[model samples]
Target: MSQDLQYWKQLKEKNDASAIKYFYDQYIKLLYKYGYHFCQDATLVEDCVQDLFLRLWEKRSSLGDTDNVKLYLMVSLKRSIYEKLKKNSKTTVTEEVPEDTFDVTFTMEEQIISSETDQITKDKLLECLETLSGRQKEVIYLRFYNGFTPEEVSEIMQISNQSVRNVQASALKKMRNNMDDPLLILVVGKLIESFFHEI
Candidate 1:
């Protein structure tokens, strides 16, 4: 077993505070980023993340084993955020969160994009990204940015495996058709390399 899995098992079986803290220390930043995508409220996102860990610790005795702790955490966090949103909506003071809130805004580091392309190409890439639907953007983010497999994304998004593949395919095709330059396509593929930075 990998070290992460071992730590997770320790956390589950022995209620190891150090093991749980190790996970929190490693993933809190990424979790915050992912949670922020679901709800732009930074404070709300932070609360949900803390609540997730607290609930995990309380329920650790009955938790199942997992080979992919990061994926599991992300799936749990997404659900937690949505549940919180739903609860908030039921209250008197209403807040509107659009169904398609998986917005993707690109922030290219000078070293990453400038060395290869000028401003025009960068602009074209951003335009191409804008063409994708929120679902498509979410699929792309989960697939490339987070390096999740299609099956994994299906689990995270609560969609069918084929739907994940279809959305990903259509999103890529849309971007390819929108952009004339091949370099833009290359950049899109390299989105895993901090192209989708923490919000």
Candidate 2:
């Protein structure tokens, strides 16, 4: 196992407060940002995150080792968001979770774009991003931005590995329509292209 993964596993097994706090500190922002994609309420995200950590701490000793700490936490956060939303949704009959509710913003400050012309391109990219389903965007964020492998993404997304590949294929097909837009490629990075090629 990787040293870093082993370190976290040891920390969790020992119930180290610093390690627990470090996990919370390191991931809170990403978790909050990602959770907001599902539910717009900031306080709800904050509460769920806090509750997630609390439950983790409460069950730390019993938890199994994880090679990818971030992905494990991310999967937990996604579940927390969905469960909270479902409970608060208060439907008498089961209702489908809205598939298009995710929102992700790519800002110019990220330095992938630098010119006024690129600003227009950034706008176009965001417009194109909206063409994707929420799960598509989630997979893109996980696979491209965060560098998770397809198997890892399958675990975090709670889908079969085949399903992850299928979602990636579909998302890329939509993105292929904009392959001529160099600015879009630059902004999201050639990671998209590389990911597609590898798949």
Candidate 3:
């Protein structure tokens, strides 16, 4: 197993505090960012993230081992937020909860040095992203931003693998149509350059 995978094993087998801290340090920002995508309310996301780690720690002994710790955490956090929202809201049925909850906003970093042309390109990228549907955006974020496979994304979003591919294809096509240079979409995610070519 990789060293990264060992941390999870350590936590599960030994109840190691360092392993917990390692996971916290590695994933807190990502978890918070991902949590916010589901619920715009920062406090609820923050609380859910905190409670997630607490629950993980408390239940470490019974926790199963996994090669994909990040995915495990993401799945756990998603369910935690859903349960919390279900409890807080009057909507008793799962189907009654709004499906249009995924939201993503892309912005250029202030410190990145860029030319006038670069700025315009980034502006157009943001506009293109805004035009995508929520499911499309979520698929793009998972596939490109987080570098998850379509199979993994299906697990995360609770959709079929074919649905993941279809959503991503539609999203990429929309972005390609709106973009002046398709390569410029790399600003959004690490896998964009390669995935752009694949589609």
Q: Which regions of candidate 1 deviate over 4 angstroms? A: 91-99, 109-119, 180-199
Q: Which number leads on TM-score?
A: 3
Off by over 4 Å in 2: 1-4, 92-96, 107-123, 178-191
Tell me each candidate's TM-score: 0.81, 0.79, 0.83
Q: How much does candidate 2 score in TM-score?
A: 0.79
Name the 10 consecutive residues with the lowest summed lDDT in model 3: 108-117
The lDDT per prediction is 0.78, 0.75, 0.79
Estimate, for each residue in 91-186, the C-alpha lDDT of model 3 and write its tens digit.
Answer: 766544565688988654442223444666667767888999888888877765787888788888888988887887788778767766646655
By TM-score, the better pick of 1 and 2 is 1
Which runs in model 3 stand beyond 4 Å of their true positions? Answer: 94-96, 108-118, 179-193, 196-198
lDDT of 2 at 129: 66
Q: How well does model 1 score by local distance difference test? A: 0.78
Number of the top candidate by lDDT? 3
Q: Model 1: how large is the Cα RMSD against the reference?
A: 5.3
The lDDT, on a scale of 0 to 1, for candidate 3 is 0.79
**Residue-wise C-alpha lDDT for candidate 2, range 167-193, written one tens digit per residue:** 988887786576576656675445346
In Å, residue 186's CA in model 3 sits off its true spot by 14
